[model samples]
Target: MQLFAIGINYRTAPVALRERVVFPLEQIKSALQALNATWGSNGLSNPHAGLPAETAILSTCHRTEIYGAALTGNASSMQASMDAGYAQCAARWLSACRQIPFSELTPHLYTLPHSSAVRHVFRVASGLDSMVLGETQILGQLKAAARAALDAGALGAYLNRLFQHSFSAAKAVRGQTQIGAHSVSIASAAVRLAQRIFERLSSQRVLLIGAGSMIEVCAAHFAAQRPHALVIANRTIERSLKLAERTNGRAIALASLPARLHEFDIVVSCTASVLPIIGLGAVERALRARKRRPVLMVDLAMPRDIEAEVAQLQDVFLYTLDDLGAVVQKAHTQRQTAAIQAEAIIETRVERFMRWLDARRGAPAICKLHEEAHRLRSAALARAQQRLACGEDPKAVLEAFSYRLTHTLLHAPTRALTQAQDEERARLVQLFGISA
Candidate 1:
């Protein structure tokens, strides 16, 4: 099997297209299973019956990526075929699964095969490929993806090893380099943008929507400002309450947002909801209720917790992930040196992983070689046993066994050397490490 990756990310596609391919966290396992089923029969029976022997899907706000190993019997011989055939199949599968036009999606997709796939995953896990350089969240997201794939039975030996090494590479980069120095994550960027819109976060009423990791991070950042009041609203009251308790804030039902939207001066939302939770009409109502008081709204969700049209409001300031990208980019130059070091570390790990993968590909040949040796040894033992049974001298029987085993082991190589051309003979000699 050959490893490969196909996807579209912030650099290759906009949110409009990226959002279209998002496999929601709750849907990831099912989506992975579906992907496997699309390629081949699922379950324990005949796992390698399809093109995709292993697979994992990583869908975050900025990217939707699929990492997989194609079931090519002879991986080295089918490189060109696997590159085009597997990529096209994956692209079509994604298009069909997401109900997207193949033409529209293919233009933005990037298909990486073999070592390139390994290198790309390593860079991503190390945060060198993040919109915010050296950000650590993508590593967690990748771990979650691997876990999901494993649960779905879509993860195989190849991907399992790849992800583990990817994690190790990430840990090494973060520990050995200064890539995380002065890190500006999306959560912090949202806070920074809110600070710019409002004179002081301490005096503002902050409302956080959703109870996921992003919101939790945002809450921590905004909480550090000692906002006048912090409230977390979510569809799940228990989850919201837990997050609120951690941040020393209050929790409210998501349904209450429509009724109390005007209560907060700053609203930050990041949810998995497919549709906008806060619509333009809701914002308009909130604005009127507040008598056009300015509200700073930051949306960290992909489908967007806040509507795009809300940006048109005269007294409302709205920012999406794309808007926060610029704020995060400002810190990119500061970490360039660390990023360079991280890249070197990732390259080294990538080569190491490829070597392991190559060794793995030779496993069947190694198994066969061991089996042949065992057969020869057994056959030689049988002849020695027969001589012993015929009342031959024990020492003589042992000597005959040793001589036959040695001759048998050397017979193949001796015959090959005799039949080989001069160049081939030299190669065979070197292979056996035979002296002149």
Candidate 2:
């Protein structure tokens, strides 16, 4: 069997492309089932006809990756396929699933096999791959992905173990290293950017667009500043109410944003919407109403909740994900020493996981050996019981039982050793731990 990870990340593709492939939380389970069906069969149950019997997908704002294990197949064929490019089949599946052209998506794809896949996941789980270095949010996002795959029945032994190991590795990285020290989350960074424009957040009105985790975090950060007012707008009023209750803010319908746009001094938006929600026209009207008063806008969405044209408005300071990336990059450099230490920890865990994987490959042989030993022992025990029932002396019966068990256990090794050539004889000697 071969383990692999195939996908694209923020490091590989820009937000424009990454957003195209994102699997929303509600769709992840169905996506996994579809992927499993395309791979043909379960490799664990029918090794010859399947690829990636076990599969899990990690889809976050920064990346969408498929981690899987392909069971018994033609070694040469699989190797040749890997050499040609290991990600083609999976990438094709993703393109079809996400409705993107393979040609357009292939350039940004990365395919890592076996150990590389293991190491890549370990690093990802440990926050080594996050845009904001050492951010803890991705770890939770990955766990949610694993849980979704499990619910879909797509996760098998290999993937289950891999995710468990990755989680433990992440815990170790967090507990043993200083990678998280003084770390800046994207939400806090947005707040920091807003602080740059407004002398004090206490005097500014803040509006959060969307009720997702990013927006929730931003709400908490802004609330701490005791903003003049905090409002949460969401497609669902229930969701907006829930978030607003927690942040001690007011809930508003997302449809009312344009009418209320000029009311807030700062706006932060992150949503699953495919198209931009805030347009230039709305902002222009809002600006005119506010007498051209400056407003800070941060678009944390992948495809961006704010229109690109909105950034061109003179009275508005709009920041997209790429802008936040640049801001976080400066914080990432300060933790280089801790990150180096964390990488070392991840490497050790990767080696340990690979060793466990290698042992799993020999499981069939080990099971067969166990079955054979059990058969011989049972046969010997039965004969001893028969002899005793036939009225043999107790002492003699016991001695005979020991003799029979010992001879039966050593018979095959003895015969093989006696008839073996020099090399085979030496191997037998070592295998059976012979005296001479």
Task: Provide the lDDT at 318 for model 2.
Answer: 91
Write candidate 1's Cα lDDT for 1-436 as tens digits.
6888889999998887888899887798888877777664322123233267789999999999999887666655446655546567678888998899999999999988789999999999999999999989999999999998998888989999999999999999999999999999999998888888888888999999999889999999999999999999999999999999999999999998999999999999988899999999999999999998999999889888788889999999988898899999998988999999999999899999999988988999999988998999999999999999999999999998999999998898899999999899999889999874
lDDT of 2 by residue, 1-436 (tens): 7788888998999887898898888888999888877665322234443356688899888999999877745445445555443466678888988789989999999888778899999999999989988989989998998999999998888988999999999999999999999898888889889989999989999999999889988999999989999999999999999998998899999999989999999999999898889998999999999999999999888767888888888989998787888888888878999999999999999999988988888888899988998998899889889988999998998898889888988898889988999998988888888767
Candidate 2 clashing pairs, residues 3+ apart or interchain = none
Q: Best TM-score goes to which candidate?
A: 1
> In model 2, which range of ten residues has the least summed lDDT?
41-50
lDDT of each: 0.89, 0.87
Q: Give the TM-score of each candidate.
A: 0.93, 0.88
Range of the 10 consecutive residues with the lowest summed lDDT in candidate 1: 41-50
